[model samples]
Target: MITSQTLRQESEQPRKCFVVGPIGDPHAAHGSPEREAYEHHLGIFEQVIAPACEKYGITAVRADGIAHAGDINEQICRHVVESHLVVADVSSGNPNVMYELGLRHITGKPTIHIGEAGQLPFDIASIRTIRYQRTRSHLAGARKEIESALEVGLRDGFELLTPARVLRGLQSGDGPASVSEIGDGANREDEDSPGLLDDFAVIEDGLDDMTADMEAITKTIETIGSLTEQSGAEMLDLSEANVPMNARLAAVARYAETISAPAGELNTVAAAFAERMVTMDSGVRAALGLIEMTPPDERGEGTEEFLEQLMSLDEAAQESLAQICSFGTSAGEMARMSRYLRKPVKEISAAVQQLTSAITRMGEWAAKARALAHSSAT
Candidate 1:
């Protein structure tokens, strides 16, 4: 007895989508690299993501566009969890972008990934990323690809990603699968399963990112420290040789310029890593809450499998924790050597502190998970 108007109303999809990616430095001087990066990413949002979303009556909002003045991280997390859809630019594998994407994935909502043609990370290379060059033709094609992907997502509804599927006891013994296997809406599961598995997947991915970023950070700090030491030696040699004051000053200026890019990258990545660690801690707490609320009888026959998965995650976290702790100690030493690079070093120290705290919380969650599984097994 339902009319066409009523059917249309019932089938209407939500129209808000949050975009996650690098926005670059807005206050960077004109004609600088930072300014150019800002413009380039902004161009992608306006010329690509916006037009594609407009086709489906969706409004795309970036984190920077929010008009409110509360905590930016809080606002971003809210949009990530509450929005009907999320589109993440995975180019350069930015840590903050990955963390936000992980958050969205935990919700099992509609999400999309896009990136520049050659910059996608190897870890996520198999996922369906809408790759685009800056050329007009490529950008146009990318926009169409996004629209088509969105059309499919809207029609078929959100399916579980690989990590979520495996943790939910839905898919057994599979490593991270390609987007075609899980992301294309081919495999749908029961909605009654506990959401704890979702948080597990999020933490799994976040830990992987944390480990990788920490290694990169360690290498960067070492390189900066070495450069600073070498530059000091060169300056001393120039002075001892009675080099002109103007020439020495010019050499020092050149050395500063050489150090600038890596220093800036270190700051950006460290800040993002700190934010992600905070989010990871929240995920751990949420998982522990789920463990407390889920009774053993409700887990059915999959309790053992769930325990195995929980143990696997704990092992992986332990391995990553070792690497992180090593980096934390080495980075502090390197920072002491290169005191001129204070800003980025400070950020690294802060990130290391936050990550350690998050891992400690994760250990607590693991203990609770083990106990829960033991109760179910007995």
Candidate 2:
């Protein structure tokens, strides 16, 4: 069999993903059967599912990580919105899992449902569930079954996944699949308009370039800072020497100050980029519907208008992330300078802190932006 590392490498080659079952049961704390069911399900994820993902080059992020707070639901919504496929385990008819699965079905992404043998819920008995005996001996068989199911599900493409039944399952108050139908109509209208997708791609590329630039600039700044600090320390020692050494010290101070001026400017640039990055983060979230807009019930509500707004937000976010990347590069340069400069111990320490903080923020912002953009695209 292929190793987990090999599977991870292959999975990394493709960006598609799926959200599986819940991680924990709330009722487990109360000693309820629901809790046991949750545990049984989690075992499937940890022992069987996670390993299988490693083998197939698929990334499986569970809903449990995001569900501890009320934010679990939001996380589920986000994953469904972004993932290319979803595999839902509905063995015991868990309400939360079913609800999320329903959302996946509506979005029209490829979905595969699996459940333990003899435990299939009545409502979904018509849908096939891969059967597995809950025993150590059955694990290998279960793994093979899941992997095959995933490959087939992915091959079917996203269109087959968005059935009317699935959409109906997710609609509020048992409403019909009118929302999806409307969405379909809007998609048809935009079918010939390639500009939307193109514009989004452009923004994404711009952001990537900006991030690379920022990283480079920040590295340069850090190098210069280190050099300046070192020179300062050397000058201090020269100050204690004879006249010739003192003269050398004066020259060193002048050189250090001159080099530091550019570093200071670069620091400013980095800060400006940080501001832009935050803006991009907000924009991406807005575009992805993580942030609320006017209610759907508002006057003049239409799907096209909503989509237009979402696209606009995505564009803006992309721009902001790009700017952030630019700033991060400059900051990195300053950090390197700090490492080289050998200045007063206090000042060097402060600069080090600044560099560290800036780099950390840039990394975090980049991750969030990427996640947002990716989710939307899928």
Candidate 3:
């Protein structure tokens, strides 16, 4: 019953900005030059970039730094779309970095661009990119400039700061294609800044999107639970239906020692099947309990650990689902065997009644034959 609206309200809490940059393994086939170039950049990110973002009270994360198992590209894209701000390192002009930066542009949210000064491609060269060199001094200067830009951008709500947004504003500008850039280029005797608007719009959009994802995950979990319960109920019903078969099977052994072989065979199969079901059911129940133990509210200190465990429960649930399907198949085979044996059991019962009638008729026929023989002899 936790609705999307409730989730949205909960997600109103701010999270880290995503830093889009190229930091994959340097030793990759991209050559020693590229490797040496971006290798130290990771450190720069931690020391300068992260600290700058933190100054604005926003946590910053780089793609490789996230501890998750999924498609890396997907995670990066999602982070870019949902993050409070995107700080793109356009230094090496790496394809991946540029791709992510393009996505950020499409959102038109608060984004800060930075790169090495002389290396920028002409395509984006005109944009006011905070440039830095490899030297620590330039790194320090870049941090200061970026920190100031983030503060101002956050304040202005980053409405018209993207390439496309700038173009659109120009297409409609009554003043002129004036300011050299889109944003707090406001004070620039050059760049055109989109005048102020409500600061709440972009935040609201991100919240709505994040909340929708939460709602979808919630629905999936609920569906898995429901299906598990239904399968369990069906298995239980089948177990009850087998009670008569169990009794009849036990009677088979008691009625004739020779029948004990087949009866034991059936019993062995039944016991094995039951044991598997018990084990599978226990696993499913444990997983369900694990999920339940995670509180609706945050678990505070152990929250991350609990959430990780919670994600692992999906594997258990999947295993249970497979077992239930197997169980259904085994049960079907048992039902089929029972069906096949029914005719023989019924025929045996009928033949015993006929046997008793035959014995009575033979006794009467023998008595008449003996009397006729005696009369003939006299």
Highest TM-score model number: 1
Give me the runs in candidate 1 sitting further than 4 Å from their true place. 1-14, 172-192, 197-378
lDDT of 2 by residue, 106-178 (tens): 3444566777788777766766667667897686688787777655433432234323333223333343223
Candidate 1 vs candidate 2: the TM-score winner is: 1
In model 1, the Cα lDDT at residue 117 comes to 84
For candidate 2, give the lDDT of residue 330. 45
User: RMSD in angstroms, all models?
Assistant: 13.6, 18.2, 29.4
Off by over 4 Å in 2: 1-16, 26-35, 67-70, 153-159, 162-189, 192-378
Q: 1-378 in candidate 3: lDDT tens per residue?
A: 322243234344534678887785666556675676557678779867998877655678888788899988667777776666678888767766765665565445567788887777665676678988888898999999987776555444444454536323333333322222322222332234331112122322332342343334334334433543554465466577776657655433333333223333333332333333332322222222222232434223332332333233333434433443443343344434445434333332332233224323323323433433343335
lDDT per residue for candidate 1 within 239-291, as digits (tens), equals 89999988777766665566667766665665666566565654554454444
**Per-prediction TM-score, please?**
0.51, 0.41, 0.41
Which 10-residue window in model 1 sums to the lowest lDDT?
A: 177-186
Clashes of each: 0, 41, 5
Clash pairs (backbone) in predicted model 1: none
lDDT of each: 0.67, 0.51, 0.50
Better of 2 and 3 by lDDT: 2
